[model samples]
Target chain A: MKLLSIKFTNIEEEWKYEKIELFDLTLLVGVSGVGKTQILKSIHTLKEIAGGQSVNGIKWELEFQTLKGNKYLWLGEFETINSANELNPEFFIELGDLKEPKIISEQIFLNDKIIIDRNSEKFQFNGNEMPKLNSTESAIHILKEEHLIKDIYENFNLIILRDHTFKIVDLFDLNQYRIEKLKNQFKTFEEIKKSDLNTFHKLVLIYDVSKSAFEEIKSRFIEVFPQVENIRVAHNVINEHSNFDLETSLIQIKEKNVQKWIPHHKMSSGMFRTLLHTAEMYLWNEGTVILIDEFENGLGLNCIDVLTEDLIYENNKIQFIATSHHPYIINKIPYDYWKIVTRKGGIIKAFDAKDFDLGKSHHDRFMNLINHPFYKQGIS
Target chain B: MNLYFILKGEKTEVLLYPKWINYIIPHYKQVFLEKDVIENNFYIFSGGGIPSIYNHTINAIKNINDNPVFDKLIVCLDGEDIGIEERLQEIKKHIENSKVVLNPKCKIEFVIQNICIETWFLGNRKIVKKVPEGLMLREFIAHYNVNTNDPEELKKI
Candidate 1:
C-alpha cells in the first residue's frame, strides 16, 4: 500500500500531527523535538493496531492506495478506560489498576464509499450490521477473513520501520543452536531462495541464487567504499576446535592492499550499514514502505552520497519515508522530496519544500531552506 | 595559489563572485569540483546569510584545515544591521567556539560590505542614472547621492 497522507493524534500525550501529504520518497526534515520520529511511529502504531495490538488514546486518519489500485481511507480512535471502575475502585487502585484501551470508533472508506462504520457499541460492514465484535481489536484485524478487509489487513505488513541507532547484530554472533537451525533451513538452495528471510540473510542467499544480482549489490557497495575489492557470502567454520565443527554463514569483504578478508563482525559499522542498505534496496519486495528514522545515523560521509543516490534512483517501486538532520543528506536529496516539519506545543505540521518556493532559484536549495524563516524559526 | 570563497548572499553574491573573480584574477581558473583544486584555482561556496554564514565559515575553516592546498580563504558577507566590526566579531566568535583552526599556511581575508553589496553597486556612477525613473530610487538618490557620498555610510532608511 502506498500512503498518500496521514493525520495522527495522541490524546494522552497531547500530541497531534496535522495531515502530512506523502510521496514516493518523503524526507522529513526538522529540528529536534518537532515530532518527526513520532510521525513514523504513528504509522507503525497503525500497523500494530491493524495487526490486533491494543494501544491507547490514538486517533488516526490514514489514506493509502492498495496494490489493486483501490484507494482506502482508514480512520479510527482507541480510548483508554480505567479498569478500576469495572471492579472495586479502592481495592484496584491499591494493586495498581490496569487501563484497558479499546476501539471507540472506526471507519474505512474505499474510494469514498464506506466499507465499515463502527462505534464503541456496534458496527456496520458494507451497510449491513454485523454481530457483536470485540472492542479491543480493529475491524480490519477481526474481519480479516472478509474479502474486502483482507487485503487492507495484509497491506499493513508492507510498512517496515527501521531505526538505525541500534546496531544490527551480526548473523554469525547468533547462538550455535540457532545458527544450526538456520544452516538446516539453508541446506536446500531452492528453499533458501523461496523462504522469507531478513535482508542480511537474503544478501547471502542472493549470492547463491544469482551471481549477477550479487554483483550488482557488491558494485553498489564498492561505489560507497572503493577500497573494498571484493565481497562474498560463504559458510565459514567459526568454531572448529571440537570434533563437530560449528559452521555459520558470513559476509566477508576483501579490501585493497589487505591480505585477509574482513568478516562481518570485523567490518566497521558504517561499512556494514552501507552494505545492508544496498541489499535492502535491491532485495526488498516491491510496494514496500520503508520508514527509516535518522537516515544518516552511523553513516560516514562517503556512504551518505552513494546510499542517498541509490535511495533516490533505485527502488522505484518501493517508498521511503526517512528523517534526517544532516545537511549533506538534505542537500543531496532534491528539495522536491523534503517535508519540513514544524511544531507549536503538541501540534506538529509538515510543509512541502515547494510551498516555500525553494529550489526555484539558481542558489543552493539547502542554503536557501536553512535561511528561510520556516526552517530557522521552525514555524511557518 | 588556490582561493576558496564563502559568500553571504545565497543568490546575488554566489552568481556574481565567480564572474568578478574571473575578470579580476584571470590566471586563477574556477574549479567546479571541490577535490580538483590545484594551483591558481578557486572555488565559491554560499553560506546563505547572517547567522547561518557563521556556521558556514566554521565549516569552511574545517575544510581549509583538511585540504591545506588552499592558499587563501576569503569570506565575503553583507554587514547588514550589525555593521562590519560586529559581523566580524560574530564570525570570529563562532570560529573560536567551534575550535576548528584554519591552516596556518593559508591566508584569511574578509570583505564586509556596509549595509549590503547592493549599496556598493550604487557607488558606480555609470550604473546609477542621474535622473532615476523609479520614484523610490529618485528619492533615495536625492537624499543620499551614492555617486558623491561614500556608499558605506548609507543607513537602513
Candidate 2:
C-alpha cells in the first residue's frame, strides 16, 4: 500500500488542504522545528486514522484510497456490495479527502456532503452523540460510502518514534513466533536454509541455499559494501514462541581466514547508517514506505550527497521518506519531493514548493532558512 | 590542460570510493606524498595538515567538519588494481596545470582537457601511461631502488 499523496486542510499558519506529490524517495525539508518531521509523522497518523484507530498530537483532516477500489466507503450500505458484487474496488485513506476526515474542527466531508458535521456530532444516520467504536469499527468503515475498505484499513502498520529510534523501529522484526503464525495460517514444507539475510530468501523460495549461492549473494552485498569480508548462513534456528517472522542473519561474515571479528557497532556511525539504509532498501524494494529521522546524523558531509544520490536517484524502487538536518542531502534528493512546514504560535503550517518562490531549490530553501532564524530550529 | 599528479601513498588511497571518482567538490586543501613520513605540522590534529600521498588521509581529511578550506584534493596510492585505478583517477582529475612531462612509448602519453559541468568540480587530466609508460614507472622505481632512499639517487640516473 504505497502512499500516493497527502493534503492538509484548515491547519493553522498554512493554507487549506492541498495536494503534495510524493516521489520514490521523498524528503521533508524546512527550518528547524518548522514541522518537517511532523509531515512524515502525520503520514503515520493519517494511516492510523484511516484504519479507525486512536492517535495523539495535532489532529488533521485525512483522506486515502487503496490501490484497490474503495469498497469501504459507506458504513450502513456496506453489505450491498457483497450482495451485488464488485461495486467498489479501490481502497485509499486520503487523510484530507476522506468522508469523515478527522480534523480538530467539527465538520468533515468526502467531496461535498458532510461526513462528520460538528453540530451533528454523530454521523447523520446515527443522529446521536458520536458513536465511539468498541475497539473494532474502523473510521474507514464509518466515513466512506463503500464498505470493502476494511481490508485496506486493516493492512497497515504504523511506526511513530522520536529522532534516535527510527532505525530500530522501521525494520520488520521477523522473529520466531510470527513464523509459526504463518505456518498455522497456511502450512507448507520448506527446508530452513542458512545465514541471516537469506531468511528473506528462504521463505520466499522455501528451499535450501547452497554454499556457492550464499557466497554469490554476499559478493553482491560486497560490491556495494567493501567492509564486509566474511559471511555464513544457519537455517531453521527460530524461536518457537515469539511473534517472530522469518528471521535470519545476513550478519557479519566470519571467515576462518580473518581472525578478528568486528561487530557492526564498531563501525563509524555514518557507516552504520549506510548499512541500515542498504538493508532497508534490500527488504522494501517496492511499495513499502521507509521513513527515517536524522538521516545525516553521523555521516561525513561529502558522504551525505553521495548517499542521497544513491537512494533518491539510483534505488528509486521503494518509497523513501526521511527527515534530515544535513543540507547536502537536500541538494541531492531533488527540489519537489520536499514538503516545507513552519511552526508559528503553537500551530504548524505546511508549505509545498509552489507556496514559495519558484526558482529556489529545496536545498537553497533550507540554506536560506539556516541564514534566517525564523525557518531553522526544529521542535525538540 | 591542467594536470595534478598526487605523489600518493597509504594516507590518500583510503579516501577513494572504489569506482571512478568523476569529480570532487572542493571542500578541503589536500596534498599527496609517500607513506612513513610522520611529523607534527602546525596541524593540531595528528595527521592534520600534513602533506602525504596515501589512503590514511580519509580520516584526516574528514576532520575538516570543523575547519574546511578547499586547498588540495585526491592523493593516491599504488596497490594492485585498487592502487592502480586510484592512481589513474588522480591522473584523470589532475592531468593538467601541474606540468607533467612524461618520457614513455605510449600513444596516450598525457592529456589534460577542461570538460564542461554544471557544478564546481576538480578538473584534472591524466598522463595515462599506456602499458609502456606504466612499465616505465615500474622500471624507474627499480632503477632508483639501487639508491632509492638516498637524495643523490637522481644523479646516478
The TM-score values for the models, in the order shown, are: 0.68, 0.47
Q: Per-residue lDDT for B120-152 in model 2, tens only?
A: 121111222223346666686566432224322
> Can you tell me the CAPRI class of model 2?
incorrect
> Model 2 off-target regions past 4 Å?
A2-24, A56-58, A69-138, A141-147, A158-220, A234-250, A254-257, A261-272, A300-307, A314-317, A354-380, B1-157
The DockQ figures for the candidates are: 0.04, 0.02
RMSD (Cα, Å) of model 1:
15.5
lDDT by residue (tens digit), candidate 1, A65-140 = 8888899999999995544345554344653445458889999999999999999777999999999988889999
Show pairs that collide, candidate 1.
Answer: none
For candidate 2, write residues A280-308 as lDDT tens digits.
44333233456777777777765565567
- State which candidate has the highest lDDT: 1
In the range B1-157, model 1's lDDT, one tens digit per residue, is: 8998888886678668888988998888876544567889987767556777777777667777776789888999888888989988878778788887887998889999888888878788899898889999889987888878888787766
lDDT of each: 0.82, 0.42
Q: Candidate 1 falls in which docking quality class?
A: incorrect
Q: Point out where model 1 deviates above 4 Å.
A: A81-96, A173-196, A236-247, A358-362, B1-157
